[model samples]
Target: MLKAMSGKMCSSSSILQAQKLVDQLQIEACMERFKISLTAADLVRYCQGHRRSDPLITGISSSSNPFKDKKTCVLL
Candidate 1:
């Protein structure tokens, strides 16, 4: 995904893969590679980094998943 964006044209699959990332750092890396920027509020609304707490990589789980608790809410 990063390779495609950094090199030349990005395929549809690569875009799909990038959009699923929920890590702030990974998302920022993607944004940097694409040379895109967004405000904090817009970032939350357009990006899933703050909305989801999943692991950055596929098939991985968050190190500390608080959503397991019924009292936990993802909203800011």
Candidate 2:
């Protein structure tokens, strides 16, 4: 995606394209690669404590993960 956007002028069209690329790359297709499971309480806790984390105080857990998956998993 970055390759497609490289050397392009920073116009409104380019900015919108860049945003779309981010949504598709970093936001949509990140979790299937990791096979991680997350829950609602996890999201609430993260949002509640996001500002509280400092360099030394920040903690990350691979088990009982409290982070939201990047992909949108809609059940339709």
lDDT of each: 0.59, 0.64
Measure candidate 2: CA RMSD: 19.0
Give one digit per residue, the lDDT tens place, for model 2 in 15-59: 788789988888667655532355667776776787466434565
Each candidate structure's count of clashing pairs: 0, 0
Find the candidate with the highest lDDT and give its number: 2
List the lowest-lDDT window of 10 residues for candidate 1: 51-60
Query: For this target, which candidate reaches the highest TM-score against the unseen true structure?
Result: 2
Residue 75, model 1: Cα distance from true site in angstroms: 63
Candidate 1 RMSD to the real structure: 18.3
- Candidate 2 yields a Cα-based lDDT of 0.64
- The residue pairs found clashing in candidate 2 are none
Clashes of 1: 0
